[model samples]
Target: MRADVAFVNGAIWTGDPGRPWARSLCVTYGRVAALDDDRECAAAHETVDLGGRTVVPGFNDAHHHLALRGRRLATLDVGHAAAPTRDRLLGLVAHKARELAPDEWVRGGGFDQNRIGGFPTREELDAAGGGRPVLLSHVSEHIAVASTAALRAAGIADLRRPPDIPGGRIVLGADGAATGLLLENAKKWFDATLKPHRIDELVGFLDTASRTALAEGITSITDPGVGGLDGIGMGRADLHGYLTARERGSLGVRVTAMPYITTTHALAGLEPGVDGWGLDLGLRTGFGDEFLRLGAVKVLSDGSLIGRTSALHEPYCAHAPGEEPGRGMLAFDPERLAETLGLLHRSGWQLAVHAIGDRAVDLAVGHVEEAQRRHPRHDARHRIEHCGIASPEAVQRIARAGIVPVPQGRFLWELGDGFLDALGEQRSRSVYRMKSFLDAGVVLPGSSDTPVVDAHPMKGIHAMVNRRTAQGRLIGPQERLTVEQAVRAYTHGSAYAAGEEGIKGRIVPGLLADLAVLDADPFAVDPRDLADIAVVATVVGGRVVHGADALA
Candidate 1:
């Protein structure tokens, strides 16, 4: 039998202990045809020798923000600097302002108000923007600071009360004036008025993002919130882009898209089931030819922790006496969330809710469990995104409900000290509790939540296993996992979250041909040097997508 492609002479980690190593693999029609000794294979249409380099199943980012990532590539990045002061931030904005055409909007992102001390006022933004419309997004993407010109462009001057929109806020000044900060839905009002990018431009950015992912050994990604109208418009176009790229032999990674559920009413026309039910245009969660597929129904339950707006059970540590409860905005009321969950659950759609604070996590978990009791979605594999501050009770409930906790392990490294300062040591100790979740028998799928955190799996693995901050401070040593456990969360555990464990994840026969070759065995490397381990090559669907020379 002739195989479409064959890889030989490599150290392969199948991610399955039973068949943890393989010398060769045959692929046909973009799926693994067989895995065994090269001598046993009859024939192959194409062959590539790895020269004894390491190989493993392609890394899957179980949760990420793809469109936001693309946008950030073109925006002013303030994330990499330290203690960004008012002057430093404006200096960067001013620099970007010079690069833009007059009257064209200047956009930037990844600014953390926590580190910056406070958000910039509209007047300050206007001065730095040089009379042009300027919009800078918070690192969390839940909030944005816009200049007066931008507000004028959006026709939102002297902002009065909006019609009680859920899950959003417009911060007001002492004089009862609207500040430049637009939280959640309010940010959408300004974003909607911004210039739209051509589909080709978006596709190009996506190409760049994909290449970057491959360089990091990422072979698959689950996009948490794809902006679209009933899975049409942007979502449909993105799906087409992936398919077109694959068909034209340009794509090298797999994508699982989750539709954002801002309005449950939109799902009315969409069908249910993995096949033709919720599926459309040859796309289904577990279907397709392994390039793109529909995954989960994503819902934003609360705001961002950095924005100091995530719904918490107690007031923020920084809150003064007699202050309003710092509990963040909820996108939907409990009744509304319950209604949406019931509809989706009854329709057999998988659900993933973004819940950050302990209170938000409790609410989201309650809704999922209640939906299960009312509608009984046994195999949907519901998940809670950003279970960042899970209490012991919440963790137990998550385990009891059999919900997957997709935690952003990198946050511990990225914001550990700040979190420790903000939430107090007691609460901070519970941040990204991988070992606790594992002990409770809950599946803990590690993720990067890119654009918010760096999307390096090694960074996540190191943080998960070490439970240390970037400065080497031990934040939650008791919550650390073993090296093997962390790796499994990135590989098989993520696959299970997306309901693709049977087809992807492991480097075994009958699975999609997605693998990553590394410079050294992660297990053998020093724990402190784990983040330095390099990706020698990355292969997806039988093709060498990156580092062909390294593989040899």
Candidate 2:
């Protein structure tokens, strides 16, 4: 076959076991024709010399929020780096509030109360915002603090009778008033009442995010939670936003959309436990082409580990000196979870359940066990997102069941310290244990729960390899992975999570021609230097989609 594009003088990690390295490759019909094959069949094939650059399969983030992350990119940067301390965070937010009109929404996010000692109170926010309806989300997205004006705007005029949401909490002050902090499902009240973004408006943000992902050499992403609104106010259409971006000629990367099945009635009549899903669109898991498709049904089984909302088998260490220890609450009954999961499994849908704490992980595994016995479907490939706090027995079950764990490798770098503090030494020794998973024959795919941490695959790889926290403390020396193992998770591991390993993930003949050209070889570089390695170019579908002559 004639080649549409040919590459030579390159060091390519093919991700194939047999043909691991390739000096040259050819692409035709948006698929790899051959690796290191010499042929003169084409008279007009385009050839490019890679100048000894390293090529790897384009990264596929197994779990991330697409449009929502794009929206966060447009919002205020109240992250730890920006604020550093409580006073600085308040000042930054107040400064932003002063610029916006009082009637306008003054939304900000990425503020970590743990860094600032404790959650910011309503009075503190009120003093800074000058009557603006300011809201600052926690780094984990499981918690947030709102100004009094914002609380009123969100229909929370009284904390005394706050909305009774399942698996969520409204933090109240000693004065019997709302403290302005909302946790878990309580955050959804604000999310449901938060202002809505039109399809085009959301597309703008999605486009920006897509471009950013491509520039970073991320050719594909699985948005795990679409149609799951996390804000107050109703009518979220982020799933449609992807369609809008693709239709408007703005989509820059491949996307795998997973519609969240929630009881929030987030999507019209598509609530959890509901039948006749995708009847109108006529799509379910595995539907659509390579460009975009439905991958799994996302169901949150619990909250964040760092936020102390994730259900734990044992009581979590107290966050405050005097506060009682908490056994994190489960999001649903285990029996009901089994029934719902069985229905989805029998219906031929893939499952991506978020289970952070050990108990949540156990419940998620139990549900899968029940579902498998009820339906007995092979190759379900069910994924446990986070799968953070796994027990010894649960790890065995996960490996035996062959469930894919989509973990945030970046968490080892960013949240390892907090995890250590919360779980204590013995339990904390195994947080996000990559080595444990690999040792148990479990597939561990790398991902960043973006908006929670940096989404750079190299950064994630570095974390997995080093297990170094932000403060330069090595938390779990036992959980570290080798550079190659880490890279494999980011590429092939993620593809396995989405059932796209056959076409994508690997640079091999007959596979989709998705490659990322790096200026430095990851295999040869010092482990510490991985994150510093830059992506020189990105090619998808046999075409250079980013960098070099992409503009041409």
TM-score of each model, in listed order: 0.91, 0.94
Worst lDDT 10-window in candidate 1: 274-283
Which sections of candidate 2 miss by over 4 Å? Answer: 40-44, 230-236, 263-282, 549-552
Top TM-score hit: 2
Q: Residue 248 in candidate 1 has what lDDT? A: 58
Over the stretch 216-331, how does candidate 1's per-residue lDDT look in tens digits?
Answer: 88998888877553221234355565565566555556888786674234333444533222333423345554567777778878877768778888866764567664657776
TM-score of 2: 0.94
lDDT for model 2, please. Answer: 0.81
lDDT of 1 at 469: 79
C-alpha positional error of residue 305 in candidate 2 after TM-score superposition, expressed in Å? 1.1
Give the Å error, residue 501, model 1: 0.2
Per-residue CA lDDT of model 2 for 1-552, tens digit only, reads: 578888778899998888889998898898988877767323327887788899999988887677767878888888888888989988987888789887776788887666778788888888888788888888888888988888888887676777777778888778878888888888866787764677777888788888888888898899877765553212356666777789997887888988776622212334466553332443568888898898788887888888888988888887669978797777667777677777777667788899999889988998898889877987899999899888778889999887988889898788877887788878887678688899999877889988788898899998999888887877768888999899899899888889988888899888898889898999999998889998888888878878867323
Model 1's alpha-carbon lDDT is 0.76
Give the worst 10-residue stretch by lDDT in candidate 2: 262-271
